[model samples]
Target: MKPMRSIILVVLLTLGLFMLSSCTRTDAPSESHSIAPSQSTDNTNDTPSATARISFVSAGNEAGFYSVEEYDGHGIVAYIDYATQTQLPLCGRPECRHSDSSCTAYALVENMSIPVLAVINDKLVIMQTEVGSDTLPHISIADLDGSNPQLLCELDSNISISPQLYTDGANLYALATVYSGSGSHLELYRFSLKDGSYESLCSFADGVNGMITSCFDMSLTLMFTRIDEESGSVEDYAQVFHVDTNTLDDPVISLTGVSEEAYTIYNSTLITLDTKDALTATMTFTDLRTGSSVEYKTNALLSASGMNSATLNVFDLWDGWYRITLNGDGKFASFNVNPVTGEFFPMTLYYEDSMNVVLIFAESGNNLLVRAGWDETRDGTTLTNLKPIYALISKDDYLHSVPNYTYIEGLDL
Candidate 1:
């Protein structure tokens, strides 16, 4: 199957939008620099904090099973079998790597390999694909140990599935793309994990790049960007509306000229990536309830780590900073972009060959957690099997060598 993020086509937004055509000129190479870790000016001197439990998926010996291992910077602290849907009895031994090929956690799932998308409420939300079939992309929820797998819903193979999925206590949410003769549209769906059912929450003709649903005026409101599919576009704007009502009649806020795909609403402020050209997108911030907005520019916003493809907003905010990962181009690097200053801070840990390194979770001012795969491949492009790996980078040593790692030999499927 195709890489999931490419189908969304958010970051690869072309060079003809008004944001691109109106640019003063292309940026010179001097403005772009490979930021090394030791050069970070942001408090990289603080003492490294104690290691804590962080969640990651481990490849199992069985065809369809992956172990959800909780590592404490040293060894497995806790683990759940991803395929059997059963939690392995806590291995009585400490410092147990749990790498034994015969470990009880290994189980089979009819020879079908799935990628764990989200671990919610002790269950695994996985991306399901069929062998030799490229069109049957769907999501399934299985017990944390990988048992009782249930198909939640089938997805449009044409639309890309956002790797960043969300859950609010009871429902699972996702953003996807839909293309037809009329053009492309951004759509949202909510699956009721409890009932194995889902609903078409909404769609945006302006094309959605990123989205967040939060309580506004005591009700849930969805906030996102409305971007034009092409240059000379008229639909580019920042918008939000109540989830219970039709957005067609909702009043449009005053925010303007924003790419819908590169934004997030944080603490009542709408942060968006605004660019007239592909090379110099400005990270714009606007107050949703007020009529004020702020903008910051950076070259890093245009491309990401691996294939130098495009940037995908991971929807994480750290102490007034936003996190984004480079997707598409098979490049691997994460950036902590300040929405207020338009400055980009590239993480030090680099992934050779693959753009699979992502900042999955983080603890501000302490440690940044990342989920990645480590294999013999220096570049991730041609490897059919990758060994899953996880690491913790120190805040003081974001560019320092990875001080800790947990590696499991398995196919990265």
Candidate 2:
């Protein structure tokens, strides 16, 4: 009986090999448009796995001419396209303003074949997917000449659709959720374009199971954290972890200090600042080779008079610098912190009244994109009177304006 089963297995394997060989063809698409036979090569070394460039686009709204209404509710995707500037719409429409409740409700167009937009060799490529579906996820690949988008691949099952997309040169990564027994589980997956394959790099379970609030991918390593809610306390804890994809079996190496609320990791440094209370903490480099931790702390309250406010706002952190907005007695002020030296300095950026402001930090090539905005501004002259406007900070210290009244388009791929 065992011999018979082995023979049957061998027969099945032979038939499968035959079918796979017959399906293989040499007419696959190439980077060029010529009708040449596809050359067989190892796809593993096809593209470098690093961020060649970074791009930004706004959520689809009416003001932008080339705006895409697909990203109405979801966060905007940054694609790099140098041929022509594309516009993305903002969240609310004039008539449907009150109807939209959350940013997640916007209809999004998914393309998995070719990247919607990409930066290859410093050239921006814009390609759209030929296969259209509201249910299935696909991508389209093309160059910057508005060429026809080539179908790359289609994901059919057990996949969480991500509206937030980013790429590290060769492969693209996105935040997706998988179906567990009780609820969904959040995870990050790496998708390869050359082989049309994907693998889960990280995951977090439900409940106090360390949910990912944000991530930053630099070089071959990924620096991210899990935001876990305390069992009884209102405060949350952020556990930072660094993963190197090169070692798939053992990626995670070091962990950082836990925080009560928001934190940012950059250049191997961790910054945690609490808004409601005047408290800030910083962690030095956590050497993976040796388990060692270095930490620094400071009182959130800067001035003796400003300590009375119950609520504050921490904005941006890059390299070792931090930006924070403080509000008290109906007044506001912005301060910068040097995490290395624990020095705090005031900045001219501030908002008046009590409007909420959001800061978006993005890196484009050697440039750093910083966008700041408030609900309303008080006349717009004094730091106290002016509302937050999006500011673009370049590597050369050049600042550009992300106009509230204009449209911006592009992708990171």
Predicted model with the maximum lDDT: 1
Q: Write down the TM-score for model 2.
A: 0.50
Residue-by-residue lDDT tens digits, candidate 1, 162-184: 44344443555555666667666
Where does candidate 1 stray beyond 4 Å? Answer: 1-116, 127-138, 152-163, 176-186, 205-234, 244-268, 272-284, 287-317, 323-347, 352-367, 371-373, 377-385, 394-413
- Candidate 2, residues 134-230, lDDT tens digits: the string is 4355544433222343555566555544443444445555556566567666566666655546777766545322222233443222333333355
CA shift of 367, model 1, Å: 4.4
Alpha carbon deviation, residue 126, candidate 1 (Å): 2.7
User: Can you tell me which runs of candidate 2 are displaced by over 4 Å?
Assistant: 1-133, 162-166, 180-182, 202-264, 272-276, 279-301, 304-307, 310-315, 327-332, 341-345, 348-413
